[model samples]
Target: MKTSGNRVWLTYVLSDSDVPNALTLCFSLRRVLTSRRLAVIVSPKVSRVSREALSYGFDFVFTLDEERNTAGLENEDFVKLFALTLQGFEKCVMLSPNMLVVKNCDELLDKEEDVQQTFVFAENGDSSILRLRPSLQVFNCLLKQLAKRNGTGVDSILKKWLSDQTSQLTFIDDKYNQHLHEKASFLREEKNIAIVNLKNKTPHELDYVGEMVLQLWKSIYDKSVLPLLNAVANVRNQLL
Candidate 1:
């Protein structure tokens, strides 16, 4: 695998249930990304076995410090914020585990921008696939806002924060982060989509387009992720 010194594809795993999604995302990314490195931030809720499986596909596996003040945040939203604190990376594409990369995303890292700015898909203005220059300053600013707006979802806080700085915010084409549950008729043709966000539903629950995307996701899981996970489990059992 090739490696880019300053660009990385980042994701997070907050629990054992998220392991499959993260691994699938990592494998899908590996298929399309040649130079960019892959990384994942895992919370304590994830098992050792799961972490081992993730380490197989991702170049870096970060552990979220349990001491961090993440109270009242659902799904360990605070862990995603840590992407900003990742020193040494010029650009980081933070993606949600539920997303499947359908094509090359190198164009995202090629965008020339300062650390004060952030790039996100126009679809949800959420963190489904966010591109930002890693900076401690921005990370702290978001943490302060998160505290002020207790009980608010991180996506809401991020949207409001970005809204406050319209000039610094860049909305990428919605094709980059298409939500699977949305009406298929409203979306661009499947060939143009860069990523598919399988919001909480399986392929069987979706329409034809969604079924196709989920079928691809399942294919990656079975051909790549599942085999790696099985190998990890086998090695683990032998040690025990």
Candidate 2:
């Protein structure tokens, strides 16, 4: 699929139980999306994503079929589940599997300067169940794998935006009769954790965006539109 000048594309990755989540996301998203395309990456095990998603004319639909490529390697854990999803695209306006698109996002990718190669994402706080608190071993494994890649920026981009340390220590687990997480202390300060490339300077700060609007635009333009443009330019596709 040629991506040059394709406009923005909404990319989503869904699991088996996420069929309803896909429906909710797509129906609501269609109303707000004017210029971009919607690309859904679904688990092969989930038939609903393919069946129910047909009417939307998604720009592309991919499946999570691990049998087709690399597995068991250290990088597999980080990119394994997503490889099938990112099959043909280079850049994307990605959303969490559970996010809901409430407002129009046509010009959300509009950029300022040429700094559109950066990836924009929100931080999942320490208290957030949505964020993964990987074991030290898992952390090291992923870190080593990321180190070998070319400017993937996986490690620096992810941050443990912590929540109020004092409040976190206040909640005692009824079964254990003590705080499950470590008590707040100077060594284990949990607030004001900064996000990489973002203006996450304080507790009230939103996740670092780092010329977010611009970066988002770049991602959309490069991943969704640029390849299409190249294809058309080279006459790679007869339809173009």
The top-ranked prediction according to TM-score is 1
lDDT of 1 at 218: 91
Model 2 spans with C-alpha error above 4 angstroms: 1-7, 48-57, 68-90, 112-118, 123-240
Distance (Å) between predicted and true CA of 49, model 1? Answer: 1.1
Q: Write the per-residue lDDT of candidate 1 for residues 1-240, one digit (tens) a residue.
A: 323668888899999899999989988887885478888988888899999999889999998875655444554577667777887787888888999988887787777653466545454565677787777887778877787785677788787777787665667677777888776642446677888878767545567778778788999999998899999999999999
- Residue 110 of candidate 1: its Cα lDDT? 70
For model 1, the superposed segments whose C-alpha errors exceed 4 Å read: 1-3, 70-72, 113-115, 118-123, 166-168, 185-188, 202-207
lDDT of 2 by residue, 26-104 (tens): 5445655556666665555555424344324465676545453332333313432243235343344444433434445
How many clashing pairs in candidate 2?
15
List clash counts for every candidate, in order: 0, 15
lDDT of candidates 1 onward, in order: 0.78, 0.37
- Every model's TM-score: 0.87, 0.43
Looking at model 1, the pairs that clash are none
Q: State the weakest 10-residue window (summed lDDT) of model 2.
A: 171-180
Q: What is the alpha-carbon lDDT for the whole of candidate 2?
A: 0.37
